[model samples]
Target: MIDEQTRSLLAGIGGFDPTPGALAGVVVVDVTRVVAGPYCAMILADLGATVIKVENPDDPDYTRTFPPLLTGEGSEPLSGFFAQYNRNKLGVTANLRTAEGRELLERLVARTDVLIENFRPGTMERLGVGPDRLREANPRLVYAALSGYGQHGPYRGRPAYDNSAQATGGLWSMNGPAGGPPTRVGTIIGDLAASLYGAIGVLAALRHAERTGEGQLVDISQQDSVVTLTENAVVAYTTEGTVPEPLGNAHPFVRPYELFPCRDGHVFFGGYTDKFWRISCEVFGGEGTADAHADLSDMATRFDPDVYRDRVRPMVEGWFRDRTKAELEALAGDLVPLSAVKDIGEVVDDPQIAARDMIVETEYDGYGALRTFGSPVKLDVTPPRTRGRAPATGAHTAEVLADVLGYSAAEIDAMRQAGAI
Candidate 1:
């Protein structure tokens, strides 16, 4: 839930707080550098957590060097990709491999409620910040571990990215149009999906620990999460002993549930119900059950889906061709389930998204203000609002050491000079 003050502020007609900077109280220690880990920490920061993102100086996040970093008045080595994923985080560089650095992290850990890291199995254990040590340091610390495989199994120690996970999990094999080779999803679906799952697990664990003073390690596998995105391919393989092929945008076993051509773009329409099928037929000026009954009525008849697809395609395509994106979204919302496959620009420019505050803008000191997607979750009393831009590397190192770890300025200066911070 959004806070009373925030809600009241938002309800004041014109606009609420355009730039709600810091989220007070909650603190998070982010031990991750790349996408999935940083994404989880960013979400926590958005939800009022004071996130401290740790980075190894020698091996900085690859994304930091992702080319042509944003330039501006207060912009400090900002990566275009990093900015989007790590909006509200404070970056601090530390050589965790060093004894002093590890001890510094331990001191920070003493004040952290949550820790996020994505590495191969036992990687953290080797680094001395594994769940057990973190728990001992802070008895109620909720640690989230995200990896390619998992904490166990033969491939647990393997490294992977979004493409690898999709291929290993059978999701790639189920992609593309029919007769196409296995292909990874266009977006980093596996990585982001695993992050979302990790976030949920973290919050759930946090709640339990807060209630009973018990903390647990959350194990999120990108491969396992990717497997869930396999859609109906595995079901067809196990149940009917049929190896499914690339289905593109259509359901493998369902008829009329596919994409069709539109005037400007494409429309994804159809559902499981016979009612929508009937309505679809009516939209094409054909009798609901006159010719499409073979695919509609007989469940087993889907074995030869091409026969019904021939008749259904032109019918839905006709309706889509006659309508615009706006018209299609409105009609779909009113009549049946449908969607306009608008591009990224279209999505960001949508008015409805604006009204929902789904698209937001925040001023960055160096880069002015830019609009981007908002968090998906909505809380009435504790809303997750964008709290300014990401901090510069080592920007909050002194402040965090002083405030959380209670280190003296002399000690902080020494740590900086040694390059172990």
Candidate 2:
């Protein structure tokens, strides 16, 4: 348990409000590292779960050394990447190779509502803390495993990273410009999508456990998650016998639904629907242009490849070429869907993002204030939030041992001295 003084200190930090969150009474054992599992656990932590991050004492989570390092005089360098996903969690160390360490993990599982991990399949079984054993110890424990493949697939034993998952999951095949080489996504969507699914599974399992006193494994595969996000590409192939290929900035079936260059920057214009197309004609081309394109107003005609290529595309391109993003937005008003293609800098300072509290600040002791993306899951009464900064390695080992597991100070000291913490 955090002392009052320590709680006060933490509450003083930016984004560390003490309001009780939706998952306030839940405990999560985060036996994860790097992106996928840690991010899933972080989502629970942000919702006010008391998350205990367990790591090996000698060989901690390697992402703790990830880039954008923060260094201060007489202080250890901290990883901004790690901090971005690990905030609002306590830290503990347990080297699962040893009997004492494994026992420590069992104790933690016995007391936790959820235990999440992302090691390659069977790593926990090798460590003697597999889901079967842990769930046997606590029948109501939600065991969530996030991995590149899954726990029981042919590729379960194979090693995979984000790119590997994307490649295998069919995202790479459908992600590049038309007629160009297949390309991996710009971000780690494979891992992130799996994390989201894992979180959803955990919440659902928690609800089941609450009603039935039964817990189950949430097996989330990055490849499977990525496949689900292919946006009808698989169906397009299976039904029509046509392999989906990248269409660059344009929608596969939507004519004139793509990015167009403006006087200042690019803007995405979705004038595919008849209503929006009419609005676009009125705003950009006026009545004369609308009359000229009267036959193209029919959805079937506009969606035809030859019609779009020879007629619709030329006119839409011409309409946007002379206008700025702001002017196009003004013309669009609420009649059409249009948006400027904002870079990261512009997005960071965007008024809509600011108004929605999509950017938030978190303060570290020596690091001052660091801003990161805020939670997209907003709850009215029990809003999810960053409760505090990420903990240093094993920072709360003794506290958690004593407070949650009912361990004495001397026992914790002994475990630390024995290199089992």
lDDT of 2 at 362: 80
Per-residue lDDT over 182-273 for candidate 1, one digit per residue giving the tens place of the 0 to 100 score? 66789998889888898889889888877887878999999899888777777778998988778788787676677877777787776446
lDDT of 2 by residue, 93-179 (tens): 999998889999998787678999999999999889999999988899999999889999689988889998899999898888988
TM-score per candidate, chains pooled: 0.87, 0.94
Clash numbers, per candidate: 12, 1
Candidate 1 at residue 52, lDDT? Answer: 76
Candidate 2 clashes between residue pairs 3 or more apart in a chain or in different chains: 93-421
Tell me the TM-score of model 2.
Answer: 0.94
Find the 10 residues in a row with the least total lDDT in model 1. Answer: 7-16
